[model samples]
Structure formats: structure tokens, C-alpha cells
Target: MRRIATAVAAALALGLLLPWAMPATAASAPPAAAAFRQEVPRTILALVDLREEDTIRLSRIHTMVELPLNHLGLSVVYWNVADGLPDLSRYPGLRGVVTWFAGEPFADAAAYIDWVGRAMDRGVRFAVLGQPGVRLERGGRPVPLALANRFFARFGLRDDDGFSDLTYRSKPALADGTIGFERTLSGVLPGYPLFRKTDARVSSHLVMRRADDPASDSHLVVTGPAGGLAAEGYDRYFDAEYNRRQWIVDPFAFFRNAFATDDLPKPDVTTLSGRRIYFSHIDGDGWRNVTEVTPHAAKRVLSADMVRIAAIEPFPDLPVTVAPIVGDLDPTWNGTPQSVEAAKTLFALPQVEPASHTWTHPFQWIFFKDYSRQKEAPFLDRDGTYRPTKSDDHAAETAGEVSDIGRYAVPRAYLQQPFDLDQEIGGALDYFTRLAPAGKRAVLVQWSGDTSPFEDALAAVRKTGGVNMNGGDARFDADFPSITGLPPVGLPVGTERQIYAAGSNENTYTDLWTNRFYGYRNLVNTMRHAGAPIRLKPFNVYYHMYSGQKAASLNALVSVLTAARATELAPVAASIYARIAEGFYTARFEPLEGGRRWRVRDRGALNTLRFDRASATAVDFTRSTGVLGQRHSQGSLYVALDPAVAEPVVALAEIDRADRDPPAPVPYLVEGRWAFSALAGEGTGEGAGFRVAATGYGEGAMVWRVPRPGPWTITAERDGAVLWTGSATADDDGRLALTVPLSGIDPLILRLRPILRPSGGAAG
Candidate 1:
């Protein structure tokens, strides 16, 4: 979704200082003298003008600026500047602040500039794109020039008393070719504020030149240790029509250079157990629709029932979280007795993680945040139909007055009663929990309609011991080419955060399910892009229950599952993914030194840490504690942390050293096809026996690198009863491979013991 806003330009040319330059390569950039020993360094504060920006979802900060930061494994906390500056001290993990403004500067310009100066004073970096808010007026007069110069001085630049409007004759040129990637700047550029470098340490990464003169060069993007500056039009390029936009700057390299993140440890939720995570989720839309798929069509079976039989029943190997709209299951609402039975049967499946999609689906959650009963009274009807009545009497009164009510003519999908946060969160989850089989509970609340719930709604879900997810709608493909289409882990709502689904649902793939019903099969393309080059997101098979309504849609849904079955993934429940996403915002990483080591704490349910551009590093098992295994992919090391251990220490050493002078025989996981966990080794040398647990469908396949090449026997038992006993010898690489037939969802305890042999080659 794209929104149009007024684009402001402040093309001032100030030559107040001497020009100097710094090296532009990351290799040449000097390291910070001291590490943030206690800081998390994951959250970036983004300032946007909500007046024109609407919400974070529609803001350029989230759609454009957040793309690179998210790819760099960082989350953004957006703040409306009109609300004044946020207290930076509260965010100890505050890595930096980025601004993208469209409207006039906030009322107080001195306060905004001083806030930036104060943030930089605390060792926090500052980056400004588009409007920097430096040029402002208070009570109809310009802010003091000294305050603006001080802001420019942070990036080692001085504002010159110059302005230019000859942008129609200017084009952007990269100062360094190595910094450019993918899209390049073309056509005439927009007018921009001009500055001269005051120090040699500041690097000019980009420049603008006049086509007519060919000699007038203005610094477009400059960066230093304190932060950087990306002039207007340099961050993103809008077409002449302003209909589409492409990144003119290599955001990955630019933000990396801007934030000095060459050695930062990124908390990665993209992978688990040394493999990319794969999960699936179903929204509760169209649950009552009847399936038209061949055999099911003649019987007039409910889409929910057909989905369970065709999708859930056949794929016991993959776990899918099924959230039913509470109103679709409760008989008092729009649900029938048959719908209730279908929901109960689906929740009983061991492969399904029961969840709730809210009591009555609120089309636009923000509409009810500050709901007014008197305002809604004229349009409301409580005839027990749970449907909105034709409000011809109040049509004119309600028309053009409602905001945040996306698409839907009414505020909610069902409107028999007034909106209630508790009912939508806790009440809905409680109803679903009762339908779930013994021991299993609703672990997550799937956001309905707009999916943008308020802070209280998220907090209510947390109160029910459940997590919340949806919203984000992350997708990256040919249509939505840039990583901008892929949102970060979640959005911060006051004290609570709303976790987003990893991938967009079928509704997006099928163009709102109106045409191209088979387009969902192309989801593999997004899965491919999100993994390669850099694994930015997990493999998520997200769709609506309505996908079962048509044969083409049903086939597309199965195609995605079949493709997932063929990939190397750690398949987990969607609730587990929500928890992992929650962990991304809460996990604290205390850097030990450089980026080689970190003391990770409070990483609840988050089980992995990734270090990019670390191909030469390997986990130093002897020096590290609470490590399960590590895998090197895309030139990055994915280290899986043991959840059983509290406050694990991850230490990285040279891979060459670990390979040459290998440590004593210790069984460590290499990779597995199933979800593996709770690995513990006992004894020493060849006598060591490792105990691990796993659960999955299909055939259970796994490999563990042992101390030496030799025969090993694996005894698998469930609930103290031996399920199977198998043995295989370690190969030249000391990799022990085992295969077991997994027929159910019960967790299996597997014990791997080295089969000792006599010196004569006989069994001992």
C-alpha cells in the first residue's frame, strides 16, 4: 500500500567550512574505541510526521527506511515528532535514530535539534534522510542558525548560506562505484540542501552535478562516526509521475556505513537448528464457505472440513496453526452446529496449533481504539444477526467521517454487539482453548481484518498467556521488488509489541482473492528471494481458510506445502514463530569484544544468533557455553543456542584453528530434517553418549558430527518405551547419520551411544 504526501525540499547552499573527505570503504573505516557492553543495539528510533504519514504501515520510514535496517537485522520503533522527542534513555539498546519527514518541521525546532545533539552525545548515531527538520521557524521566525549548524556538525558538515533550485538540470552520481547495488540513480534529481565537509573524517558517498555546467558538484550523502546524511531524493527515487519508487542508494551498504555496523552481532530469527525455519498459519476468513473441490463439492462440505482433510490430514510432517474466528465457531453468532464440529475436529489434530482470530472480526482495529458509543449508535443494530443493517438514515452522517476503517463499509465483520478488547483477545482465546484437545492451549491470537490492534489489545493477549501476530504482510517478489515490501519482525505499540506474520497470506498472492486464484503457487518465488543472498525471513505458508473453497486455490495451497517438504527447514508451529519474533524485541546481547563474542541473556524462545560476513569464524565450543550447533550459510554463521541453558555465552574463534587443532570428541549437531532440541552429552572420548529429542512427520532424518569416525547406535524411546534401535558408522567427516520412521506427533527421546569395538575389530 502506497500513500502520497507533500515532498518538501530545503536546498540551502552554505559554505561555512573547509571541504575534507574520509575513506568510503568499510574495511578502511576505523572501529569504535569502546563497545556497548550493556546495550542491545538492535532497535532504531524512527521519526515520522504522522500527519501526512498516517500510520507506521503507510510511512516512508517503515516502507522505505526500515527495509535496509531490517535486512541488517534491526527493528524500528516509530515516533510521531508532534508528540515531541521520545526519551532516548529508556532505550538502552537504541542503536541510532533515522528521520524521513514530509510535512513542515515540528513546532519546536530548537528542541528537536537539541534532542539529536543530546542523542549523539550519549554515543548514539544519528541519520537523516529527506527533511532533517533543521530548517524550521518558531512563532513565524526562523530558528537560530547556530542550532542548525550544530546539527550539521554532528556529521562533520557545516551548513553553507546557499540555496539552489536548479534541480531540473542536475543528476546524481555515485562518489564510489563499490557502494552502488541493484538500482542506480538516473534522470534529473530533486533540489537538496547543500553542505561542505568541515572535517576529513567525514566521507562523501554521493554527489549531485548540473548537466549543463558539468562542474557544479554538491555533496548528497555524507557519513561519519556520529551518523550520516542522505539528502532528499538520494534515499529513494520517485518516477516523474511519482507513481513508483526505487532506492537510489544501496541501503544495505549505506545503513551499514551510516550506523558503523560492520562488527555488530545481529539477532536472527530467520533460522533455527542451523536451518531456515518453515511455518504455516491459517486465518479464519471464509471458514463457513462450502468447498467446491471435486469430491467435496458434491457433498457440499464446509471449507474448514475440506482444509483439514486435504491440507492438514495429508501433511502431518508440517505443523500449521489454525485460528478460527470466534464468531465463526460460536453457535450464537454466524456459526452453525456443523461449523462448531468442524472447528473441534480441526483443533483436535495433533499437527494443528489451536488459535483464535478474535470474537468479532474488527475490519479496522484503530476505529475502536477511541470508540464513541454515541457516534456509532445511529448505524448500530442489535437484532442478533451479527450483521450491519442498511443505514440509509445515517448514511450521510457516517459517510466521509470514519477513519482507519479500511475497505469495509462498516467498522467490523460482525456487529451484533459493541466492540470489546477483552472479548476479542481473552474471550476469543478462551473459547478456542476449550475446543483444543487436553494439554494443548491457544498459544497465539491472530489479528483480524486490518490486523493493526491497539496496545491494550496486544496486552490483553499477553495477559491470557498467549502471544499476538499478524499485520506486516511481508512479501518480496517481482511485483513488489524491493525489500521494502518485507516488514521487520513486528511493530512496537506503546509498552506492548504486535508480532507480524512471516509471510503474506493468500489474499495478497491472489490479488485479494478476486482474480488469479492460482497465483498462490508463486509464493515459492518469495520464499526463494527471502532466503538467498541473505536469509531475511523464515519460510511461512500463510493463507486463508477460503483457499479450500475452489479447486485451483486448494491445489495452490498444496503446491506450497509440497515445495516446503522438499526444502531444508526447521518446521515449527506459528505460535513458536510468534514467540521467536517476540524474542527479537526482548533479547539482550552483551558484546564481549568486537563481534567475536557475546553474552546473550533474556532471549526467551529465541534460539539463534547470526553473525554476517563471518565465514572465517566458528563456534569455540571449549570457550563457549550453552551452544547446540552452528551452520555457515550465505557467508554467515547461524549458531543455535540451547533453550535449556540460561544466559548462554557465544564465543567465536577462527574456523581454521578449530579445524586444524580440533577439540576432544564431543557430539554436536550438524543438521536435521526434524525439529531437534534438548541436546546434552555425557562421558568423554569415544564413550560419550548424547541425549536429544525430536518430533516430526514423514521419516526422521538427522546428522551429528561426532569426535571421531566410528560405529554408533541410536536408541529412540518415547515415554520410557523403546520405539526403535538403529546404528550407523560415522563417515570421514565424523558425521553420524540416522533415519527413523516418525508416525506421530509424540516427542521421541533419542540416545546416541558410541559402539565400542575391540582392537581385534570384534564387537566389545
Candidate 2:
């Protein structure tokens, strides 16, 4: 601890530490000490046991509860119950606590109960799934009925010393409109009945009935202001053989009603500029592999070069973040001069955002948590090279730990030297930044191999001022067939968080890139599903540089990009998407005017907020501050906020009705292809106009809903140089359309001046 403090002090004195970076002391302690202050209470604490197979990543709660809560735009903070409950008071805007335990009870049942009671005392609601903590007891003896009932009473449930009716043949029945949604309820329900009766305040969503006894009906699911309970098998049904989960209880309705999340001001990351966000990122794998494609194959061109020539150069309208593996680009490793030159060329592109894929790609990141040179020595090949050998495969087959070893035969893709976290994270980031042009440093770090770096590794990436992304491998299509396949926005990695790539790469689609190379063409299906019905994720085109090795894989990538270009989307850098995801976890909201207005703060780079089922509402410009404009899509109103504003107040008002007088004209943004910031609107007379800084790709398509009907001259300028000037007339409803051709990614200043006539009418 003393050494850490000294190092931190030295770093602070030398100006080497970023303000947002996690210090060594903070990383060792509960992250809440640093996070809770700025973050809003939009997080649900999910409790699980690391000793059990059911963890936060692969538990019933992840597949059932987490997915639904994500749809409600909520973030999850996972806590291992064995670690004891964190100080809930330290965490602000904590919506509630959730628990789902299986098999034997927790090690200390009494302590668990006491912690839950303490949380309840603080007005933090608890949602129990499968086994309730109060019901769990040490040894064979049961918890006292008085103590158990006290916990149940909080949920409006009254225990009558009854537990499980094993012989009773019963089935679950959905209560009218409750319970069954998406997946229908079927088969006999498992019995471990707890409560016989409930208070009048309880709402029973699902009930169980006995086949023979008419009076033997028990509450399978119940909820109230205090929280809810779904007993045993009624919560979810997991098919162990297929590794799939089907919900017997509707997760959306359950979480919404249980947590009261219906009207919360959700910080949405999916939409921007009134359209779905589009972003692309490429992994640095296969950068040196020779292309097998036509034309490029004749010259023995590297896959990375071919990808730059074909996929990247053609797409000037889209921004793609290129993350190069430091081992592939640095000459000290196996990298050649050609590889280094390719990386320098790629990072110089105007549309490309430079990033790092790590120094040595660790295949099984968990193995390095307690790294041991002796333990890893056995896995290295006898030839001195760290590549996989026949012996390693035989050992893996005999050990039956294929999942533990990950995709590679060894623990890490590069193991020539001892594992060093600093070299793999910070060193790689610095190496990539040096390869980029001036003013364009490495903005993100893409996790390689297993993509599950430990807490310290994640903190190291944060310390370097880089956003960590990759992992989750989110996919939803006919093959995966369920929302359960879609992971949450990101994972809670102890003191740090890892932002996940929005969609899976070509490897998953092509069965590890062995066959069906064209399988990635079907990515369009996952992209479409992720958006429609409900916007669960943004449009992310994630792939490897190796896609250029085969014509089919490269074509599939081009096809997806073409489809993305045709769609109405607000294209942003991969770093922007990472920051937006970070915003979802850290953004704070203060609801005012009975939920009609919200003061959003500490949102990071997330510049858009969405209100679902708000077709009748519009941004009240007069009341709203720091608002750029508004756009409506799929029955949801997306309000664009100016990132320059420290705290933006979004006020929603009813749309002007026929019965009411038409509102005075104010030049307000309707929609734009470019991203806007530092927006300021002024004057309602002849000089009535607005000025905004815009940055984007392709031709800038924009429209403004003006305050009055008249001819308007729009001039776009950059550094006092007028790029273009055009005149257009506002329609009767007051919408003036304009276009500004964008040739670069830099922000341009746009000023609109109303061209008035003597008669205050249309002019030629």
C-alpha cells in the first residue's frame, strides 16, 4: 500500500496521471468510493456467487433479468455475495437489488439476511428469483419463522411456516395479462412453495394450481412497492444440454413493475441525430496474412493492405476505428517492416481512428489474474516458439477443459516472455499513438483473444486515457434465435467496466472462419433485429483485417458496409460509441416537472437522450437549455444535446394542436447528417438565425424548422472562410432544407441568416 501511494504521488507530481484514471488505492478498494459520486441511481445491483457455476456473465439473471432491464435502459452493477454487500449508500441512484441463487444455500445465511435487511431499511427494494436469501439456512436446521416472515413481509408476502409441496402435481397459470410474454408457459412447474398468503398490497402476477386439490393454489410470482419474488423454476427454464434459456415470466413486465422503471429518463446510446448510430471497428488479427483474393493475390499483398485498398478507401462517408495489435506492428516482436508501414498508412487516413489491440494477445485472460511463470511453462511448445503444438491439443482433450483454455491451445497468443500488464495495455496504447498522425492519438484499446482482462488490466487501460472495448460477442438471429443471446451494454469488471462490441465479428458467423466464409453476409439480419421492434443496440460493423484474405469474406464485409451506408444513420467513431456506452453507466439525471423535464449531467460523450412512446411530445425549445435539436423515429423522440454544455435540461411539451394558436417561429434543427455541438439560436426578427459547429462524413444533409415562412440564406464557414452559400424558402409549416458538402472529419461552423422581404412573405 505504501509503495502504491508513493507511485501514485510521483505520477501526480510528474503530471502523468489523468483526472479520470483510477488510482491504485481506488482500484484495491470498492469502486463505489470513486463511481457513486458522479453516477446516477440507474443501476441495479445483481448478486451472485463466484463459487457457483451461475455467475453474472452466465447466470439466469444475466439471460433473464439483465436483458429485460437493458431494454428499459438500465445499467447493472454485479456483486459477488461472498464479497459481502457494498455500501449501498455510497452508490447514488441505485434503483434496487436483485438476487438469484441455486443449489445449496450461501455460506453464511445469517449475514446475507442481515445485509438484505439493511438494504431494505435504506428503502432499497429487493427482487428475489429462484431462492430467497431469508429461506437459505446453514446446516440442516431452518431459519426461524419470525426472521423469515420479517423479510417476506417487506414484499407484502406472509409466510405461514409452509415450504414446498413436493407430491402436489401442479402447473403455472398466467394471471390474465401478466406472466407469459414472448415465450409461452408450458409443462408442470417445479414446487418449492414458500408463502401461503399475501397482504392486500401484493400483486400476484402468476399462480400455481394443484391437479387434484381445488383449494391448493399458491402464489408463484408476486410484487409490490417493496419489490417482487418468483419462486424456483417459475423464474426461468434453462435447457442445460443446449445451453439456452427461456423465460416463463415476462422479464420486461416483471422488472418494469417491480422496479417502477416505466417513466424514467433513459440515457439511450443506440440513436443519434434522430437515427440509429452506425460505427465500424477492425481487429488487427491477420494483418500479415497474404490475401487469397483476385488481383491482390497476384501481387502477394498483405490482407491489411488489401482491406485498406478495398473496404476502407471506398467508404469515405463512414468512420472506421483501426486497432492494430502492437505485436503485429512493433518490429521488436514478430512484426516486419511492411507490417509497421501498413499500420502507419492506415492510421493516417482521415476517416480512421487509431487504437491498439494489445502487445501480447492473451487467449485465456483469467489465467493471468494470478500469473505464474512456472504454471505457464508447461503450456509453451518445446521448440521455444509459443505457438500451439500436438502435445497441447492432446493435453486439452484429456483435461476436458476446452472452455477454460478458450479458442487457442495455449493461455496466450504471445508467450515469448513473462506476462506484463503494463506492456500489454499501456505500452501497446503508446506504441499505436506514436504511429498515428499529429493530434490523432490512440483513442481506444480493443481487447484481444478472450477479451476478459482482469480489474487491474482494465484500470491500466483507463489510466492511459483510452476507452476499452471488445468482448460480449452480442448476436441475435435465427441461429442464436433469442434475446438471451444479446448481452448487456457492458460488463462490470470489479472497479472498472469493459464496453462490449455491439455485434459479433466474422469468426462467429463463419464457425471460427473455417468454412462458409460468406456466412458474415447474414450480419445484416442481426443488425436489422437489433434495431426494429426495440432499439436494443447500435449498428456496429466489427471484423478482423483477415476478412480481406478471402474474396468471399471481403465481399461479405463490403455488402454489410453498403447496407449500412444506405440506412439512415448517424455515423460516429468507434471511440464515440465506447464513450456513449460509458455514459449509460455513469450519466446522472435529475427528473423535474413531474418527469416532463430532466437535467442530464456527467454524461461523458453521450450526446443523445431518447423518450420512448412519446409521439405527442416535442422538445420545448423555450424551456430547454443546451439542446441542439430534436428528431422523431419509430414513435420515440430523440433529443440531441450539445456536448459543450456541462448540464443540459431537456423539456418536453405537447405538439401544437389545431385548436391552439401556432407557436412563433424559431429556427430549430429538425435533422442533420452531421453531428452538432455548441449550438446557439438568436433573434426572432429579420436577423433571426442560428449557428452550430458540425462534423461528419459524406454530403451534409440538414434541415431546420424555422420560426416563420420566408426565404433563408444558409452559409457554411470554416475558420472565417465561407465554404458555400445557398438560399431556400421555408414551407407553410416552416421547414427549410439545406446541404453542406463535407470533405473532411473536422468540425465546420454553419450560420443561417433569414432573408426577409418588405412584405414579410416569400422572396425570389
Candidate 3:
């Protein structure tokens, strides 16, 4: 203790205390913490052993309970009951204790018994998942002893039947002899590979329980009564992702039914449930159900304000440009309304959020550029003054133009020449915000393929306080996967594009990799994607609007979501998705000299922050003033700050900082200008600014920093012929700019041979 104090004092002398170290009067904790101050804990104590198989099983159990608990504003504080019961005096306010125990023989039985007795006296209830080995009485006669019998014996809730081969169907009051009633909710997604197209369209599974049992505890929030699928293929309890077998409910679909029926226990934890975001890209889907289902999804959302919702992200920049094959106002080209009334209804429900897909929706890389000699063309040729230039109709049609769906099988990236920040992200965002309902402001900024966006464009987005969900997270599995494959732990959501291309038809057009499937193939992908629900972290799903045009694709969509529901997968709102996704990557617990610095790069999961400073004051730099307090048990401190706001610094909440900087990410361009760091065969660039591959797969940029006061010769060639070339003096300010167009056949290069500058002026 003396050593710790001395070190803390020394660190303080060195100015290592973060801003959050100040007292509450200096700054406030986040709102979440403030809420904690006013209530008895809407929390439960979770006892676990956390051994091998238990980890996976426990994780699934948590997933199953997430929605119900979250809805009821309840949290669980885990205690390792494996060795023996830990002290719980600190958590006296906890509403109850729960475990998924089959009576794992434990040590210090006496102490556990005493703890349970005390807890029961304090009115702290007890619950378990499944049967957990309880003694059953048949016709008031004691049958046989089973594991965890002490628990049921103490509760005095007699059950006439022991664990039996019983099936509980999740239907509307169709009695199967279980406690309580919960109706099943089902839906369909047509794009995935797994789903029973002919027989069982709804993803279904099994559950195990005692025959003819009654509710064990009164006001017990959970009453498990599940059903078997009528379909033959999905009858048994198989974790299709891993091919594991056991007696349990279909983990994925169960949560969906739970959320839909509101059938689980009331929440004892607080949730950012209302804080949401929706991400959509319009590459043009068929109007069949998309036109119909768009309204259907909307109508479903309108009626119940379900946990899942949709927000439109149209390419509003298209219409204002020159006439072309597709116009901005045309639903096909985006930048237009799919349905004004739908938009109004969504906006009114405060359920819809709008995002920007740029005006022209060009390849996005080079289109925002300012051409040195040609910088004045968009304004000169299209308009006057200094407004950002709109891409010509040709810009919307060619190789380096807008993203044309099904244009290429494997989407190749290229440098967008003559690009500008204002034209791409800024202008689009501005235009849409004006057109959007006052309540439906957009927060998502999507790119053609989440290619390298300029740092400036990103900054402009952040200034509006929005996180960019701009990348692919994963691809669907083929035919079917019995087990789910987990995503790389460190990967952040939306930043990963995990692709698995298999189905009836697989093709690549422009930047899109399309794999269209039919009946069985769709079911395969659905089960495979749904198999490992735990592995589906860092979440984001994207497809061209075209693929979802038919039921061929939508089936998988339905299955994936249905699986997500049963597995307790919550589709975060676009408003908060970026933050939540990023949080997995950025959240940290830092040990400091005198204290600790706990920070998450994105909005954190509920109660993710639990420190030991009971009296410490915390302030969040992300967005909240912060609520500072600790849980009663073990002085565990959890902060209540806003989600996803960046730089949420916790003060006084930390012991101290060592003033260490984390290693930086690999060096890459922060600006829109691309500089090559390496080449395929040449190895590293050795400090050279750019590298080009023989196959023309690389990054290149032609950007100038300082302005020169003179006309300049500039040329851009597609093949053997020059696509564009011009000479003009720097307009007014003497600044020059350029963008390299992205293409497939040959690499575009800016050459040196001839800029004849007069006199002694140096050619930069």
C-alpha cells in the first residue's frame, strides 16, 4: 500500500493524472452512472465456474437472456460458484441469483448453503436454466433424487414429474404443460443459404424440460416452454454451426421468439436499446418484395417498434448532375425517394434514420479530386463561382464512374482522380439533411465498397458526430455450416469484409461479388451463417439492392434474422452501430501508476466498465458528463457514459497514468491522396511515396501541396489515347490539383517529361 501511494504521488507530480481524476464538482460522470445512484440494482448475481465447455454453454445462456434482461433493465454480476460461493454482502440490492448448474460437485458446501439461506431470508430469489437436477414427486410421492435437488427442496415448489421426454411448443396458449405462455414470432430473409424453403420457412429447433411441470417461482420472469419443428431436418437439438449435440433450445431462434413475445423476465439492467442506427445501400434490388417488403418491414416496425429497424441511405447526389443513363431522382440511380409516405411514416415513428451514399455515388476514390489545370471544369463547365463540381453524365457511366451493379465479378479499386471532399461526403450529407425530415437526419456515410476514404472526409463526418460503418464484416457460409466460425477477435465491425461466395450462380461485376442461390443453397447459407451466433460479432450485412429483389435471396435474409432472434442477436441502430462496433476494437482497461484509465473506442456493451473505485469521480470525454459509482458487491465501479462518443476520458476514476503511448497502426495515408508504401514484386517502397504492380493492383496519387502561378500541362489517358489534357494558369489563387482515374486494363501514371516553366521558377 505504501509503495502504491508513493508511486501514485510521484505520477501526479509528473502530471499523469487524466482529466477524469478530478472530483465530481470538476466534471461529471456519464448519465448511466447517474441512473445507478437512484435505484436499487436492477441486477442479478450470476454464479459460474467458467471451465472449458462451461464457457461456451454459459456464453450461449447469456446470449439467450440478453434481450429479455435488457428489456427488463436487469444486469447480472457474475460470481464463480465453482470453488465455493464468494461474498455477496456487497450486492444486497441485487434482485436475484441465477445459474445454469447441473449440480457440479463443489467445495465448501456449507458456506454455499449458508449464503443461499441468507440470500433467501433477504428475499433474494434463485433460478436456474433448464432442470439443473431437481427432485420430483409423483402424485405426492417422492420419486428419485437428482442433481441440484437441494435447490428445489429448499424452495418447496413440488413438481409431480421428473425430467421427462416432453415437447413444449412456443405457440399461443397451446398448453404443453410448462409455466406461462409465449407466442412464437417468425419471419423470412431471402438472401442467405440456409432455410427450409418448402416445409419449415421459419428456422426452428428443440427444447428439453420436465413433463407437466408448473412455474417454480411466482413472478419468475422466465417460463421456458419451447416446441419442436414439424420439419424433419431440424428436429434434433443440433448446433448446426459446430455440429455439437445436446439437450437445449435452438439458441438462435429462441431469442427472436423471446423478443417478439416479450416472454422473458422483466429487465433488471439498463440498455441503450433506444440508441440505434440503420445502414443501407441502394445498388438497386428488384421491386418485387423489396417494393413490397420495404413496406412490410416498415409496417411491422410501425406496429411494434421492434428491436430491428431500417434506415434509408440514398445517393442524393445523382439527380443534380448532367443527364445520363440513370438520374439521381430515379429510384434506380438513387438520390430519390423509394416511397415518400414510407419515409414520412418511418420518420414520424422516429424509427427511420437517413444516411448519405454521396450524390453521384461514383467509385468515390478519385471523383472528389480537384484537377490542377482542370480544377475549374465542373464549375466552369457546369456552374459558376466555387461550388463543388457535379460529375458529368459520363462520370456516372464509365469504368471509373459510379458503382454499376453486376458490372464486374470481382470489384477492383482504383484511384479517383480530381476528387474533392465537399463534392463527395460533405455535399451529399448537406443535401440529404435538408431533404430528410427534421427528425430523420442521417448519420451513416457509405462508400462504393468502403474503400479508402480520405481522412478529411471522415473528419467532416465526425464533426457531425457520426461514426462511419463503411466495410464488410463477413460473408455467408456455403450450403450450410453446422457450427459457426467466429470472427477474428480484434476485428471491429463494418471494417471487415468476410466473403464466402458459393451458390447456384457466382459472378463478379465491377466492385460487387454476387453469388445468387436457389432453394436448398439458400437454406445452407442460412444455417451456416446462423450456426455460430457467437462468432457474428463486429456486425454489418451489405448487398446490392438488386440481389434482394426476389425471394431467391430474401429467404436467407429471413433465416439469418430468425436465427439472430433465437440467438439473441440485436441489430443495433445505425446511429449507434458504428460506436458499438468500434467499441470492441477500442475499449480498454489500463493500469496506471495511481489509478486506471478505462476507455472504449466505441460505445461499450452495458456494464462493460467495472472498476474498483467506489468513491472515485469519473468524467467521459466521448459525450457524457458521466455517472460515477460502484456496484455494491466487491466495490465494482461501472460508469454510465454515452455510447460511441470518442475520447471519453475518465478522471479521478483512474489510479494514475504511466504516460505510455500505445503502438501506432501501420502507416497509411491520412489524406485522400494515395501514396504507395509497397509493390508486389519490388518488395517495400524503401521510403518511395508510391508503388505500382505489373497487374495494376495498387495505390497511386498525383497531388501537389504548394501553388504555382502559371499555366500547367496535364494529361489523362485511358488507353493509347489521352482521355483528358489541358493547360491553364492557376485560377486566382495559383493552386493546382489532380486525381488518377481507377481502371482495369492499364495503370494510369503521371509522367515527368515536360512542364516548361519560364525563367528561373522551379517546376514542382
* Model 2 TM: 0.86
| Per-residue lDDT over 541-566 for candidate 2, one digit per residue giving the tens place of the 0 to 100 score | 99988888799999999999999999
lDDT of 1 by residue, 331-411 (tens): 776667988999889888777889888887787778888986554565566553333332422111111112112356667
Off by over 4 Å in 2: 1-40, 107-118, 144-147, 159-178, 192-197, 211-214, 372-376, 379-405, 591-595, 654-665, 682-684, 727-729, 762-764
Residue 676, model 1: Cα distance from true site in angstroms: 3.1
Query: What digit string (tens of lDDT, one per residue) describes model 3 on residues 144-199?
Result: 43323343334432233332222242222222222211212222201111111122
The candidate maximizing TM-score is: 1
Worst 10 residues of 2 by lDDT: 393-402
TM-score of 1: 0.87
- Give the RMSD in angstroms, all C-alphas superposed, for model 3: 25.1
In order, the Cα lDDT scores of the candidates are 0.73, 0.73, 0.32
* Better candidate by lDDT, 2 or 3: 2
List candidate 1 segments past 4 Å from native. Answer: 1-37, 138-147, 161-182, 211-215, 239-243, 371-376, 379-384, 387-406, 593-595, 657-665, 760-764
